[model samples]
Target: MSMATYIGLNFSVKLNEDYTEDEVEIDYVFSSEEDRNVVKQKHFTTPYIYEVFEKDEPIWRMNEDQKIHSPHNYEKSKKTFLYLCHLLKELLPKGDYCEVYICWLGEEVEECEGELKFNLNNLQIEAIDIYEKYFIRIEN
Candidate 1:
């Protein structure tokens, strides 16, 4: 018998304002297959921070909060969400039902997308379509 599993996908994006030197970060979690797929297709933006070292070394890094950008305003964030969903679908077994958890970290409080009461049925179907086109199934 196949074992039941819960899958989690974490996505983040960061945006730095060139003029203000301010940054915006965003994160999203897909708990249900339906929500996951919906989030994947949606368009959002990603924010990034650049740091200069003493030796003139330039480094780009994301915050520990794993915040990307505002999903309500950006398109890249949506793209990142989609990519995450793809990864989750590929990693999970086909026969087992899965519960996903998503967490989005911002400058302040983290925002959540899906709830345990809701399942990602539609999102899972979309993920499967993507998997068929991009992922190759392996036999154990």
Candidate 2:
């Protein structure tokens, strides 16, 4: 069976000064799928903000947090969540706060929620409260 997990990043952008909008992408028709598929397919893309170290172990690996999966997969899931935390830290502004919400809703695991607050001032993860329908394995 395939594993699926939802990964999302939410933050705000505040401009210091007003500026006019630049050129936008004009709507165009594509003759074929290949013609429209200009962007490369990737697990996730964050230009200069963050980079994925391991191609085999993307953040989506956290989907293995199910009872059907082996302990090894679970271990990888744990590690991926750490990477997610680091990614969130890197994406947040120095003085801004971002809410991190990751969920693993597998058959056996049901729904596992990880909520956190990134403390930009100290470069530390301040609040971490994870709730799981099954037994929790990932550490804070």
- Looking at model 2, residue 123 earns an lDDT score of 34
| Residues 31-97, model 1: lDDT tens digits | 3344434323331121211111111110111111223343232233334434434543454355433
Candidate 1 has its poorest 10 consecutive residues by lDDT at 52-61
Q: Tell me the deviation in Å of residue 129 in model 1.
A: 21
Q: What is the clash count of model 2?
A: 0
The local distance difference test score of each candidate is: 0.26, 0.32
Badly placed stretches (over 4 Å) of model 1 are 1-73, 97-121, 124-140
lDDT of 2 by residue, 39-115 (tens): 11221122211112232343333443442465575455456556555644565555543322222222322333333
For every model in order, what is the number of clashing pairs? 28, 0
TM-score for each predicted model, relative to the true structure: 0.26, 0.31
